[model samples]
Target: MNIVKVDVFQARLPLIEPFIISYVRLDDMPTIFTRIELDNGIVGWGEAVPDQNVTGETWHSTYDVIVHELAPLLIGKSPFQIDAIHQQWDAQILGSPSAKAALDIALYDAMGKCANLPLYELLGGRAHDTLMVPRVISIKTPQEMAEDAKRYVAEGYKHIKIKVGTDAKADIARICQVRDAIGEDAYLRVDANQGWSRTEALQVIEATQHCAVEWYEQPVKAHDYRTMRHIRESVSSAIMIDEGVQSMHDLTEVIREEAADMLNIKLMKAGGIYRALGLASLAESANMPCQVGSMVESAIATMAGAHLSMSRTIIETNEMVGPLMFTQDVAGVPFDGEQLLLTKAPGLGIEVDETYVSSITVQRACIE
Candidate 1:
């Protein structure tokens, strides 16, 4: 079907509470939500949550590029030609994955609706129907963080992701405290968010070995493959690359170096669903397990990751707890504790609440 209209809405959604990582603190998430309508009267939804540290984009930049630069390219184009449109975007634009991701997701939604198929069906049938999601405990005091971990575990969560890397000794204390609180059974994944030096990464990972961490993610800087390899070799826990591997090229480099045991594939970082599948393929060939994560996104991007996570068995973990942390969710889907049930509904399966969208939107633009 021919595409006709591109509507971009810029919204800042508040977190239920402040979210602090190694690099920055966020009280609210700035996002670009997209709606693409075809001449056949089908409408598709997409979203872009630009993390300045990860995607190298701001919400304002993502919105501008999508509405001004990318929307023109979508006008009159077939929504089903996903791959060709990506190639076109690459030829015309340089590096704005966040901007392109919004459009890419929107295009895929339209394609799925047009074909009357669920997203995972289009990606090849799903490997698993239910995903065990991990709740995140942001950087906080060791006691506070441990209590948070206990709260999640009490709520029947089997997986917990503890954010660290702001301080090495404090991080060690945080992990140890959480491990003690959650006991040895619940899965704990530590994400440093590239917050330490090579030496510090080694020290923190080593000191927390007794905690039985499922994985240590992005301990050092994104470019430090040598150190990552060293830590991977040194640690008893698995070492994962989140900020380290953004593209297939980055994945290739990490593979060449044998740096990481796992990869975190975010739709925003990998560009979108199509390219994320490409990343999953490369990771599969390399025998690297992947975790489908989010940049604290809404239900739109979160479900996109969930659908993709189901498409591949290699994706061992789901850390896409973005909508869970939001003060309000426009998706109108019920999320029980830690267990994410996938729907077979066409497209992303969750309809966006434009009424709720109108409340949070700070800016809006429409392209025809």
Candidate 2:
């Protein structure tokens, strides 16, 4: 069916608490939601979470590209021609993967709905029916973070990811305190968000060696391949590259250098499911593991990630806890305490509450 119209909405949702990372702290998330309507009355949904620090995009830029550039290109295009549309986008667009991702996810959702199957079935099949989500403890005082960790564990979370990389000593204290509070049985991971030097990364890893961290992610800068490889060689903790591994080219470089033990694949970074699938394939070929992640997004994007997480067996871990971080959900889905239950409903298998979305929306645009 040909796409007849496209609608874009920008929603600003307040977080339950300030989300602290190495470089910045966020009290709310600005997200762009997309709806693509087909001539046959079928509609698909998508969302884009623009993080200037992470995806190099802001809400305005993402909205501009989707409305002025991508929407015109997509008008009258068949939803079934997924690869062809993506190929056109790649050739015509230079950057702005998050903008492309918004449309890409919508196209996939539409296709899945047309086939009367969930998005995962179209990707492959359900390798997992439910995904174990990891709760992220944003950067805080060692004691505060420890208390947060304990609370998440008490809420039935099995996995906890700590934000670090500001100070080696503080990071050490944070990890140790959290580990002690959680009683050592829970799985723990750390993401530095490119906050440390190679030496500092090593120091932190060395100090926290006894804490049993499952992985250390993006300790050094994203482009610093030499330092990343050096840190990987020096540390015993598995290194997961997040900002460093953006596209297939970046993944190839990381694989060539053996710099990372795992990859944090976000739909925003990989430009959506199509390219993410390629990245997953390449990572699997090299026997590298992957963690499906999000950019502090809403349930629209989180459900998209949830579908991708279950689509393949290569995704060993999931950090799609964006929905849990917000004070209110703009959409509804089946999320148990630890696992996100995938539904048999068509498309992304979730429904957006348009009224709630409209209440929080700051901008809107429509192309027909």
| Each model's Cα RMSD | 1.0, 1.0
What lDDT would each prediction earn against the true structure? 0.89, 0.90
lDDT of 1 by residue, 199-316 (tens): 8988898898889998999999997899999888887789999998878899999999999999999999988998999999999999999989989999999888888998898997
Candidate 2, clashing residue pairs? none
- Model 2, residue 325: C-alpha shift (Å): 1.0
Q: Candidate 1: worst 10 consecutive residues by lDDT? A: 332-341
Give residue 355's lDDT in candidate 1 (0 to 100): 93
Q: Candidate 2, residues 209-290: lDDT per residue as tens digits?
A: 9989999999999978888889988877899999988799999999999888999999999898888999999999999999
TM-score per model over all chains = 0.98, 0.98
